[model samples]
Target: MTIQSDRARDALLDAAEELFARNGIDAVSNRRIVEHAGAANHSAIAYHFGGREGLLRALVERHHDEMARRRRELTEQLGETPNIHELVTTRLRPLIELLDSLPKPSWRAQFMSQISAVPSAVEVAKEVIGDADLPDDLRFINGAVDGIPEGVLRGRAYLLGSMVVGVCADQEAKMNEDANKGSWEQVGRFLIDAAAGMLGAPVTDPDGAVRYPSVPLL
Candidate 1:
C-alpha cells in the first residue's frame, strides 16, 4: 500500500511485539495491538497480517531473522574453527545488540521472559525458529569449538540461549539499576570473555564451576 500504510503496519508490529512480550501470544488481541500502535485503521492488523497468528509468526520471523543474521555474520568472521570464546562471542553479540537497540528494552525482555516460562509461547518461538531454515553456519561455528564435550553441547546451547534470553529479560534493567555502563558492544565482549572458559576449541571449563550455562534439556 502507501508509505503511510506501511508505517502503520510497522506500528502494528511494534505494538504486537510489545503486547506479546508483556502478556504473551495468547493474551494479545488485534484491537489492543492496533490501539497500542496508534493506527487510525482498526483493520490494520488484519490488512497487513492475516490475523494474530500471522502477526505472531511475523514477529518471531523478524526477531529470529535478526538473531540468525548476526549469528551467521559472527560465524563467518570466526572462520570454520572458532574457539570457545569466539563461539560464545558469536552467539552473544546479536542478543545484546538487539536488547541495546530497543527503545523500550523492557518490552523485549518481558517477551523473552515469557518464551522460557510460558509453554505455548515457547512452542511458538521454537516453531518459528525451526522454520527459519537457518544455514548450517551455526553448526559449523559450533563444530569448530572442540573444547566443550559433545554431550554438553546441547546443554551449553540451552544455557547460552538462556543467558542471552536473560540479558533481554530484565537483565539490562537490572544491570542499569546496578549502574552498569557500556552498550551492546561492551556487554557482548564481557559475555565472550566470561563464557569462553566454559566452551571452546580445546575446552577450558566444561563443568562450569564458576558460572551457569543455560543450555536446554535434551
Candidate 2:
C-alpha cells in the first residue's frame, strides 16, 4: 500500500475503534466510520478492510505482536515453576503496559471490552491471536493449581477474561476524565493479585458436581 493508503487505513481503524467504543459495534455504521475517517469514498471500510468484521479483525491484530513479545519476555523471566501470582502477572501485565504506553484517553481497551461480548468479533480475535483452544500458558496454569476441577478452571478462565476487560475499560474511561485516577502499574498489580486469588481459590466441590443454569456467561 502507498503512504496515503496506509494513512487512510489507520484513520479508519482509529475511527472505528473510537466509534465502537463510544456507541457499540452493532450501532456504528460503515458510512459513519468513513465520515469519521474523513475519507472521500463511502466504501472506504470495504475497500480497506472488506467489511466491519474484517475491520474488527484488523483492529485486534494491530497491537498483537507487541503484546505477544512483552508476554514472551515476561514468561522467559519466570523460573522453572512460577507461582500463581507470577503466572497471572505474566498473563496480564503486558496488556496493562500496552495500555499505559498509549496516549491518554485511548479507546483500545474499551474497544476490546466491547468486542469481548460479541461472539463473532471474539472469534476474529482468537483467529488472529490463536487462543481459541486451550493455550499452553493456560494449560500450565491449570496444572499448577492443585485440586481445581477442570470445569471450574474453565469457568474461571472465562471470568478472568471478563474481569480484565471490564476493569481495563473502566480504567480507560476514567483516564478520559482524570488522567491521575490511578496509575496503570497500580491497576496492573491489583488485577494480577485479584486474578491470582480468583484462580487459586479453593473449590468446594472437587467432583465438579455443582451445576448451575447455563446462561450466556461472558
Candidate 3:
C-alpha cells in the first residue's frame, strides 16, 4: 500500500479502537468510525479491512506484533534455558510494557478486555494467537509448563489471561480518571506472583472433581 493508504488504514484502526473501547463494539457504527477517522469515504473500513470483524482482527494483529517482538527479545536474552518464573514473566511483561509505553491514558487494555468477552472476538483472538509470530519463545514456555495436564493447563491459561485483562483494564480506567493508586511495575509483580502460584497449584480433586449444590426447581 502507498503511504497515504497506510495512513488512512491506521486512522481507521485508531478510531475504531477508541470508539469500541469507550462505547462498545455494538454501540459504535461504521459511519462513526469514518467520521472519527476523517476519511472521505464511508466505505473506507470496507476498503481497508473488509468489515468490522476484519478491522478488529487487524487491530489485534497490530498489537500482537508488538507484544511478540518484545517476547522475542526477552527470549534471546534468556538464551537456551530459562526457569518457569522467567518464562511466565516473558508471557506478561511485554503486555505490561506496552501499557506503560503508551502516552496519555489509553483504552486499549479495556478494548482488548471487551473483545475477549465476546464469543466471535474470542475466535478472532484465538486465530491470532494460534498464528503468533513469537514461535521459539512460546514453544519453550509451553514445554516448561508441560507438567500440568492439558485440560487443567488450558483452564489455568484462561484464568491467567482473564486476570491480566481485568487488572490492566482497571488500571487503565483509573489512570484515565486520575485515580490510579499503584505503579505499573508493582501491579506487574503482584500479577506475576499470582499467576505463578495459580499455574503451579496442585490438583486437590482429581476424581470427579468437586460438585456444587444443584438448584431447586421453582
Candidate 4:
C-alpha cells in the first residue's frame, strides 16, 4: 500500500476503535468506520484492512506494540530483583496506559467485552498476551523470586499471569462506573499494591497454589 493508503487505513482503524468500543463490535459496520474516518469511499475498510476482523487485528497489533514498548521500559527500570511494587507496577502499567490513552474508553471497553465473551477472540487474546513481546519481564519476575523451586515458580507464574489479564481487563470492566473515584495513577497504584502483596511471592500452601484476593482491575 502507498503511504497515503497507510494513512487512510490508520484513520479507519481509529474510527473503528472508537465506534466498536462505544457500540459493540457486532454493532459497528464497515461502512460506519469508513464514514467516521471521513474517507470518500466506504469500501476503504475492505481496500485497506481486508475486513472488520482485519481492522480489529491491526488495532490490536498497534496496541500490542505500544504495550511491548512500555513493558521494555518498565523492565529496564526494574533491577535484577525488583521489589513487589516494581514487579506489580511494571506488569500493570501498560494495560492502564492502553486504556487511558484511548480516546474512547467506553467503546474500547465494549470491544474488549465482546472479545472477552467471544471464544474465538479469547484464544487469540490469550496467545497475544502469552506471546507478549517481552520475555525478559517474565524472566525478571521469575528471577525476583529465584528462591522458589522451578516447578513452584512455573505454577506461580501461571497463576500470576491469570491475575494480570484480569487486571488488564479492569478498565473495560469499569467502563460504566464513575472516574471521579480516582485518577489513572491511583488505579495503577492500587493494582500494584494488591498484586504485589498477593502474587509477587511464592505461595506457602500445601499445594503451593495461591489465590489473588482482589477483584478485577482494568
For residues 1-218, what per-residue lDDT tens digits would candidate 1 score against the true structure?
89987788788888887787767667777888898998878888778988766776676666667777887787778755456566666666777777778674446666666666656555566676662232232354456664445545545555556665665555655554665565667767766776665444354556643333322211
Model 4, 1-218: lDDT tens per residue?
A: 79997888878877887776566676777888888999999778878877766676676555666766787798788776677578768767897777677663444544555565445555555555553433444465656654654445445555555555555455555654554545556767776777666545655653555433211212
Model 2 TM-score on a 0 to 1 scale:
0.90
lDDT of 3 at 41: 100
Clashes by residue pair, model 2: none
Whichever of 1 and 2 has more TM-score, that candidate is: 2
lDDT of 2 by residue, 106-210 (tens): 898899888865778767777777754344665778878888776776677777777888998999998987955589899999999999999899998766643
Select the stronger candidate by lDDT from 1 and 3: 3
Candidate 2 off by > 4 Å: 132-134, 207-218
After the best TM-score superposition of candidate 4, give how far the Cα of residue 135 lies from its true spot, in angstroms. Answer: 7.3
- The whole-model C-alpha lDDT of candidate 1 against the native structure comes to 0.63
Q: TM-scores of all models?
A: 0.73, 0.90, 0.83, 0.69
RMSD of each: 5.0, 3.1, 6.4, 4.9
Give the residue spans of candidate 3 off by over 4 A: 79-81, 131-147, 207-218
Candidate ranking (lDDT, best to worst):
2, 3, 1, 4
The 0-to-1 C-alpha lDDT of every candidate, in the order given, reads: 0.63, 0.81, 0.74, 0.62
Q: What is the Cα-based lDDT of residue 111 in candidate 1? A: 64
The 10-residue segment of model 2 with minimum total lDDT is 209-218
Backbone clashes under 3 angstroms, per model: 13, 0, 0, 6
Q: Between the candidate structures 1 and 2, which one is better when assessed by lDDT?
A: 2
